[model samples]
Target: MAETSETSAAAGDAGAEGTEDTGIDPAIFSQLLPFDPFDPAFHADPYAVYRKIREQGPVTRTPLGLVVVPGHAGVSAVLRDNRFGWGDGATVAEHFSEAPDGTTVRPFIFMDPPDHTRIRGLVGQAFSARRVDALRARAGELVTELIDKAVAAADGGPVDLIDAVAHPLPAILLGELIGVPPEKHERFRALSTDIAHGLDPSLFLTPEEVTRRDSARAELYEYFGRLAEERRAAPAGDLISELVTAEDTDGGLTGHELVVTLTLLLSAGFALTVNLIGNGMYALLQHPGQLAWLREHPEDVPAAVEEMLRYDPPGQMISRVALADAEVEGVPVAAGEQVMLMIGAASRDPEVYEDPDALVLSRPAGRNLGFGLGVHFCVGAPIARLAAQVAVAKLAALDLELETATPPRAPYIITRGLRELPVRLTAAD
Candidate 1:
């Protein structure tokens, strides 16, 4: 998740208010003294702050008690290295305590080394290309079904694509893939979205929002825990079944691990895929030439989808705590210190791509950290990519038109996507 804190100087909400910027690098302070995420200005256009941060060299120490790495080279380097990690079980348990139920639930991704290896291997099988591919036929069916509804709703009148399709497609697809029945989809979507916001609560949310996150965490565990019971009662060959019933080298997963893994599968990937489709469509519409090119060359939709991931990923930031003292790209980081890797900024860094900001559909996009890197790389990446590839190609094939100069942007710091992306079908136009 993208880190949010120390609203810009414009908002005057700096580094938890009363705290001084005694440790912030002078260079970053001069350019972004108060990088205000709380300010309306930042959410509307966070890239501006990121650009400024990126310009201040590879890594800038922040007064927020973490170093911000915005440059492409540094961000990518940190992600690929193992010295930095997010699987500190102690930290995770501390976080869970704030929730009403206060239970420690460690997802496989949060496990390091041998633990990660065991869980990933089992979970990996469920997401292997072959396993994920089996779902594509259904995914395509859902896309077509959603597009049909979108077309009918638009009737040449503008409609929010997210409302009509983007959000539902993945919400439904993930529900089915994870063994969630159609009846549970609405509740699943709501719980997943709220729990995802818990990733970096203090970094970007208001007090009430943080409270909502805490509540969501407890509810999410309960919701998924029930599903685990169902999967155990009757095996259905679902991902949940695989997780609940399968055994790893280190015996079968603990019960806590099972519930937490389900939670991760349900919440972690749900919201982001919504954004992926939203961000992809927005990018296509913003660049008409590219949009037109995509419509004509639908065969190359996968490449276009890749470009979208590189251009403006849904999940924008990754945080890691140093396991031991380590230097990233020559910048010193002490043990236990946190580093925020700006996924969005690095994707746009000029050092990484020639004309990085421009969305060239055919560019060799290389390995974008949109899905993260190394151990914690997103497990659902293949599924998310396939969703964009197929759904985007379908939308392009439909020739939907952008209905406004700017769609409503999702007003959050760490996440970027539209609140509502208004579009109209060609028949409506």
Candidate 2:
């Protein structure tokens, strides 16, 4: 609390700004109870702040004049209610200085209805149950191949799972899903990294980030557009082929839209899957009983994956704008106001689950907004879930232990993940 007081003095108390003060300092408050999606502190440990908001009330009006909804019901209500939407450019332009055209290039996930509905239906078609199920075989193969490499690299030393297992497994799988040839997988990572970094609502970007974003978008357009054209002509078996050749009758996506959609799939799938693998593995190792149970019953991999998502989700924050004067669970919301849903916090809401903070592998099935809900739900969710289930199941099958050295986490505010998790693989007796 003393530390919080010092932070309040340094950053100015919220009380002075007419907002009811959280005992935590505004600087600390910004991190924990972040009104700003890019708040540096909240990126550090948002779970603490999520708890604070849930405890205070379902709806929190931040010092930034932003509405933060933390409870599962409130967050779910906001996402499902058509009253809230992705809002116009003016809503986001206040923070990001990207060009207006650049904003149009925002991923389909950031698009509201009509456009969201159209693109999602088209993109969603590519990830049919059969397609995703077939992709699972490839995911399993990649997991095995990556695990072998991790063992070889370990050669009696600790292995960084991010390098050998977590990252490569997903990268290769995503490349295959998008029809990228195996040889180009190495370069794919750098491109995906650059594109994924801009997936946030930020006040500003460093000159470097701006450069990377522009470069990534251009490269994606050129690269995927080439692949898309080839697929349209050749009609190969992969997702890109399906997308290019998909006939919607209501006029299919334009060439530029196809390129942009492919770009979103490439970057979003890899980034989220990587985080899911890293975060889930870390969570399981942190809770040995749960880890042991998963190892003993591999058939439970699906439920375990679900629990992992709820325990430590990759997508932390999702927001929407009130399309018009509206109310969330009866709380009056003026037209055009922005409401941020804390995904990670909502999962831990006591009202939603028993022992909300604990990791329980056998926890009863529930709707987790980790992949989000409603119209904007993750289109690649099936593929992501399958990939993670295989990765975690395989990893748990080994009698390994997390390395004593603290692993480095993906320090970015956008995705919560570990960059390099070193673990010691042990032979089963």
Candidate 3:
């Protein structure tokens, strides 16, 4: 989370690279009902808007034909059903498929079965359970060090918890996970931040912001390409080296695919995980009952993290295109129509969770759409979970107070997060 002028000015919306959209008219969604990225009020509390959307029905359509699914069951059905995807790039939003340079390569997240299965499988090979699990101890150590620095830096005043722990913790670990040298950690964080703001549809951003995003993407592409080449020549014990050699029935990835995949993993993983920690902490501080409960039941950190995700998710919307005629919760969807799944709305659907809006750490562990579902479930979920749990548990051990009850949230519609969470921290005696 190296902040740029545009990113900071915009209140720091975190965008996932590759998911950035160039075409498909963000203007349509901006003006339409049930979703408005430009509205400051909506950004502050989108769940309130979501409640209105859910009241409409399982599915609602704009005059422009964008299908909006706000109910939990409908959103889940669309995600798991094979009939919905970015088929043949026709239904895929240009931002998700096309680059600023006019090239088109749908990231695996947007691809259909064969291609999606192939690339994701190769990626999964590199992202082994053993590799991810091994990072747990290291993550805890990093959180401890970061919290210590935040406590020391406060000097009896409010500190930006995001800068102290949420932002850097994930960036450092992601660098370690991807084999980035310690020297380049700051650069890595900065580029990812620029790309994160650019992750919103082009319509929501200013011209300058879009330019910075594209520029950052190009720079990252060059960097990853060089790194991949280096790894190919002499493989290291890092995930980048592992990815260089990852193969399946289709054989190894091309140099370009390797670069794209690496960039995707780095950018997407970094943004979501950063927001999870930031948003989760903000939620806890808002609910003192839950915060006290977490302190009393330290073992429940993981469960509390899940509840945080559901209560105020990092990734709020997931887009899908119908490949063929299909139905979501009995709503007919023609081929080529785009369906926007409001994850924030579905997670809070009263039909699914008891007191869906409450921050209930003790709530039963159940299926959630926080990281998504089916083939596209977040690949970095295990690591993200580990990072958030460690950060939350450590932060909760302190006497914490929010400097501002209602923090400024990023205005980006797709992802939901606070710009900064200033908290007064003191060690528990």
Which model scores highest in TM-score? Answer: 3
Off by over 4 Å in 3: 1-30, 90-103
Angstrom error of the Cα, residue 370, model 3: value is 0.6
- What overall lDDT goes with each candidate model? 0.71, 0.73, 0.79
| Candidate order (lDDT) | 3, 2, 1
Tens digits of per-residue lDDT for model 1, 136-233: 88888888887777777667677688887788887888888888888988987777777665555243344554677767767766666777788789
Tens-digit lDDT track of model 2 for 1-429: 000111112222123231223233335445443443334455456677679878878787766567778889998998899988766645443222232255445456667788778888888788788987887777878787888877886788988877777787777878887899988888887788776664432223344655776787788788887888888889879999988867676877877778878877876678788889888998888788988888788899999999999998987767677888988767899997777777889989888899988999999999888988888788888888988998988788887788954576654444578778888886554
> Relative to the unseen true structure, what is the C-alpha lDDT of residue 312 in candidate 2, on a scale of 0 to 100?
88
After superposition, the stretches of candidate 2 with alpha carbons farther than 4 Å from their true spots are: 1-45, 92-106, 201-203, 427-429
Per-model TM-score on C-alpha atoms:
0.86, 0.87, 0.90
Model 3: lDDT of residue 317: 78
Relative to the true structure, candidate 1 reaches a TM of 0.86
lDDT of 2 at 289: 90
